[model samples]
Target: MTYPKRFAALPEYAFPRLRSLLDHHDPGGDVVHMTIGEPKHAFPSWVGDVLAENTAGFANYPPNDGSPELLGAISDWIKRRYDVGLDLNQIMALNGTREGLFNAAVALCPEETARGERPVVLIPNPFYQVYAVATATVGAEAVFVPATAETGHLPDFASLPPQILNRAEICYMCSPANPQGAVADRDYWAKLIALAEKYDFRIFADECYSEIYRDTPPPGALEVAQEGGADPERVVLFNSLSKRSNLPGLRSGFVAGGPETIRHIRQLRAYAGAPLPLPLQRVAEKVWADEAHVEENRALYREKYKVADEVFAGIDGYMPPDAGFFLWLPVEDGEAAALKLWTETGVRVLPGAYLSRDTDRGNPGKQYIRVAMVAPKQEMRDGLTRLRDCIYA
Candidate 1:
């Protein structure tokens, strides 16, 4: 059994561990799940019709990268959103950004740095688990950079010692960060791109939650990289229709970068990737081209944001998210708080420690619980109110 040892140090996935901790106990009241980030909003009304119209295409093999029409729609969306024009060669479709995020690392991260050291991948401490898994898959050293409140909830790669940065091959960043819901601004993106350029590393920008904002749109990584006049290949952008269009089940996303970067990624995808089914591709083509439904989705989230604010009002240390839908709320101990909430109030949440690993500075997420704001506004309001009365009151 000479299996790979890279995942040996990795903790079990978050949700299963949450179940082991809470499932045996009987819930004290009616159960209300506010754990996973799956959206409950209605997807576009015409999605079924579109899928039906294209069902015949399912009999044929899908285009490996993306159908030209789907890719064109993605490119057009990017142009409108980021003001950056991209050639079709610079983008490829993804089943979901999860695979894209992992595969991009395998396709882009080097076996060793220029100085002959094992490559280092910089990951925000409380990161999407796939980032660490991808780093491990590629045999790179994972450097967990704390993206706590003091760091504006974003990893500060520039502060790491030059020795660490010198061996860095990839840096993973998520705007509208998953648990914390922090958006990286233009200055943040510019500085991060500059650091990648200085250290000769590439930035893997996960912008999946980019569209669900309250105010202005977040500055995109690719746009910031272009605005800063850095090498176009210095940043790779990964985005999806999941959060943006309430289409998580659609499993449509895209990876875009310079020609060389995409060439390598698409080449790997040809052999190992499962292209989006032609019917699904046709559905996505029309979905990406339409923003009316996306605007409606954002409006719904805005209402939920207001509900959360009113429910948690006047609570000390309550920092409303800049964008995205999760609330990383403070607690004395995340696991204890989550269990108590579940057993006493029947409200489910994820323990922050499950999303983070212990480090010399401590497990950054140990003192919080992540509450997803993805349920319908009224249910979310009910959940938040119960959570507030149970914990804060």
Candidate 2:
């Protein structure tokens, strides 16, 4: 069988490999799962009621581009959050940002962007799985850029050689970055936007975790791009209701960018993508337009951050995240530390090595573990205390 060569070389999914490593072992104490970044906060009380009101719409087919009402809600949210206005034509409803992140490559990344060479898709070393998969799906060369402690936990794309940048077709960035929780500031976004403009590539900002953070909201990629006056099409920002409203099951997100880029993405979605159902879109509309619930949710995460700080204070190399809800703690070997945490303290965390791949220098995540702060405040504190004592102590 002539299977596709692109995926044949890819590593197995991270979670399945993790399950194989630990599923057979019995936890030594009561289990505390600090692995996946699934938020456990309360969703808006009106979600169910809103869905019920639009239940009849479910029988009808959904528009691929999303209804005008939903689009308006998304646009309004962007305007309020980032102080940037976007036309409805420049936004497309996604079943989830996951869909937009993966599909944008297929729709926007060309077979050969620089003359006659296979274009390169730049990804952070410890990037969302979707980025690498998207690059592979489009038959582009995937270049892993080191985003480690050395680089303040963000990828430095501007440092790449001009040849690679010239062939670059896409760059994936995550703000309030997953696992590390390092938020990219305006300078970072401006620099990246300039690079994208210089190379004629697009930037895919995976900002699903943008809302769950400490202190001020992270600078948005689209807003920074606009401020830098780069070509609007050079940046496509993907955001979702999952983290914002604690509604992962709702599976609602949107892609906003230049009209031409969005038009191409919407055209591709028409043939291969499933839009959010009418009822779900109705709920998404309200969710995006409301900020009170989001503010309350941020306060909850803030409390968790304080808990982590108090628990891990005085420990060596314990960096409180600038934003987001994960702790990428340094250790000698991520896998060994995770197994020890599970066996001794019954606190399960993801080995950082599982989230990253080896590169020319080394796997940047070879000596860390990713602990998600997604439990209730008390439970989260217990988990962090156990983790600190079991590992760092």
TM-score, every prediction: 0.99, 0.98
> Where is the poorest 10-residue window by lDDT in model 1?
374-383
Q: For residues 274-370, what per-residue lDDT tens digits would candidate 2 score against the true structure?
A: 9889999999999999999999999998988889989988988989998888999999999898888888888999999888888889998889999
Best by lDDT: 1
Residue 66's lDDT in candidate 2: 91
Give lDDT per model, in order: 0.93, 0.90
Local accuracy of candidate 1 as per-residue lDDT tens digits, 1-393: 699888999999999999999999999688889999999999999999999998999899999999999999999999999999999999999999999999999998888888889999999989999999998899999999998999988888889999999999999999989889999999999888888898899999999999999999999999998988999899999999999999999999999999999999998998898999999999999999999999999999999889989998999878899899999999899999999999999999999999987999999999999999988788888889999998899
Model 2 global lDDT (CA atoms, 0 to 1): 0.90
Q: 282 in model 2: Cα distance from truth in Å?
A: 0.4
For model 2, the superposed segments whose C-alpha errors exceed 4 Å read none
Please list the residue runs of candidate 1 whose C-alpha ends up more than 4 Å from where it truly belongs after superposition.
none
